[model samples]
Target: MSIESPRTAIVGLGITEMGKVFGRSAVDFAVEAITSAVADAGLDLSEVDGLYVNPGIKNDTDMRLQSTLGMRDTRVLATVQGFGSSAGQMVQYASMAIEAGMADVVVCVYADAPLQEGKRAGAAYPGQARAMVGVGSLPFAAGLKAAPERYAVAARRHMHAYGTTSEQLGAVAVAAREWAVMNPHAQMREPMTLEDHQSSRMIADPLRLLDCCLVSNGAVAVVVTSAERAATLRQPPVHVWGWGQAHPGYVNRRGSEFGLVTGAAQSGPAALKMAGVSVDEIDVREIYDCFTYTTLVTLEDYGFCAKGEGGEFVASGAIAPGGSHPTNTGGGELSSYYMWGMTPLSEAIIQARGQAGERQVDRHDLVMVSGNGGVLDFHSTLILSAHPKGR
Candidate 1:
């Protein structure tokens, strides 16, 4: 009735090869991960009566996992696309369904192949669309073309306002690379330095190539069951302590640099409140790092730092392993394969499970994983714990 009162728990987790599971179709990747995760949970495939699959933009198909993965029949199915936010939606859906007695075991799976790598869709822009009535740039580039000046302007403004420097931003790249070096599954394990980040080609103003994430083919999955059932599983359950999604419904058609910070400010508080925890209570974090600026804005909006002090907070190396909040220990999307931020979800589960190996932290009870979508206009925050809500 109330989305399973205390919370749901993740009993099984699985992640594919981080870099290039090339030659394999996206369906194969999804099936493999689903199979492994189900096995890890010590459950038969038949027990997976619920399935949530978030296909990539290239996946023009249904949420039908039965045919691809040999699933018998799923009582619950959800197929949606929110990029980074898809998994969060699936988790929320799974929680609600279980509470309503729709299904017992739910598996949220995401897999994407670089199938559409070279093929860019040339549909009419939103402004030019016949069905919808939009203004300005026909179809907005999410501030890409028109407000091209704004991204740089905002980063420059953030720097001038907070005394942040380019070197500080590069530090994030350096630290992320350092962690990637320890991750055998990471795509970019090669060590990078501040000098390297500074000299890389610039994609957008104030954002270098190294500051952006990589694109690769991979899949990740999670098995969610009741906390009561999780207690009997092989591994300790990673409880879903709190969850919330805040869609400000603000389309950044105006091309303002303020969207990242402002949008996050809207969603962060709502999530923390639901968990009944403060930012200080989180021991680990896996914020979406599609770009270096995303993490900076998130820290400020999430109250980890003052409004304009994100650069300093990141520069202090406080986010590295053994720091105040060791974030994205699997190197994140910035340093690892960008599986639509799904890998970070797996990393959070690993951190909460105390299975992060070298990057593992002490007192790692709770982890906060935030996903940013549609220019930060859509936010999904999840609080994962080492144990279920009630003792």
Candidate 2:
């Protein structure tokens, strides 16, 4: 099924306080976010009949949330298990359900409290050891590697092919911090210069400590309903113009066709095509910034610039606040508290609605949001607009 026209819209958004320690369970945060979203939409919980959640925490299933929240009318329940890449998928599924008449009001949510449990966030995955090697199966070597090392391999390729520099990568980190300084909920608000980014300790070669996203504790929720219904809500409706998802398979291991993972190359065009808008029309961008290189590669793949030109493009400060194309005004995952990619999505919605306070941009009509998951294995994109379809 294709969404040629904007039929569903995001009517409400809510986020829990972000910090090192939330001192609560994932469900508690999810409930809090959902309650805020429902109230923000000027609707009661009883009116919600659908739920879409990213199952980050163990045993955090849709049924568990439904039972806990007493959402008796929930007719559609789906758990997108895309890890950091699941945020856009959650919104996509909710919009699909609402468009299909399976539900009227669908609430999409994500939550985690890794710090409070004394556990390192994103460290639970046991790579490669669980994979069954066979013909056409991913090699055992693929399983032996983790995210930082895998992304480093790609970064090295970009440097070799395009003469990209660590300073160019540092530009992304600095820009993220520049925006974070204005975000009260941001975890790292200290002024960060390209020099500071370069000085940070190296986690993986070519990828410094400042290049990575924060391990944060937080939750986010968004309410999706028909555009007609959303028009009657309390807040301005952010129309879902288009969305697309792509899985490019594992690109870190040996004998891969692409060598460098570029799933956004496929997903971005699909979304833009569906939205019937060119890249030039996008006023704001919230690309996934799991690392600095992630943003660089995505920019090229998304047709923002020519291939191998991302380094120079970002170095021009075009993505920084007040630049021609403002990106991640909410600080993104790099400087802001990382609730996976939900932070970026929330920022996109805020921009679309003209609700972003200090970081608000002038042209708030069209916004592009992207998400990446599992070592660049999966990618998703969404185009949100301030106006409804055919307006």
- Candidate of highest lDDT: 2
TM-score of 2: 0.92
Error of 1 at 172 (Å): 1.5
Give one digit per residue, the lDDT tens place, for model 1 in 68-100.
766676789878677777777788788777767
User: All candidates' lDDT scores?
Assistant: 0.75, 0.83
Going through the candidates in the order shown, the clash numbers are: 3, 1
Give the Å error, residue 211, model 2: 0.4
Model 1 lDDT, full chain set: 0.75
Candidate 1 regions exceeding 4 Å error are 1-5, 115-157, 160-163, 251-257
Worst 10-residue lDDT window for candidate 2 reads: 122-131
lDDT of each residue in 1-391, candidate 2, tens digit only: 7557759999988888886765677788889989999999999999999988885544354546888888895789877688766888888888888878889999899887666455555563333344565744454455425567667777888888888889999988888888889888788898889889889989779889898888766689999999999999999999999888888885445677352548899999999998999999999999899899999888888889898888999999998987877888889899987888787899998889998788888998999999988777888999999999784
Worst 10 residues of 1 by lDDT: 120-129
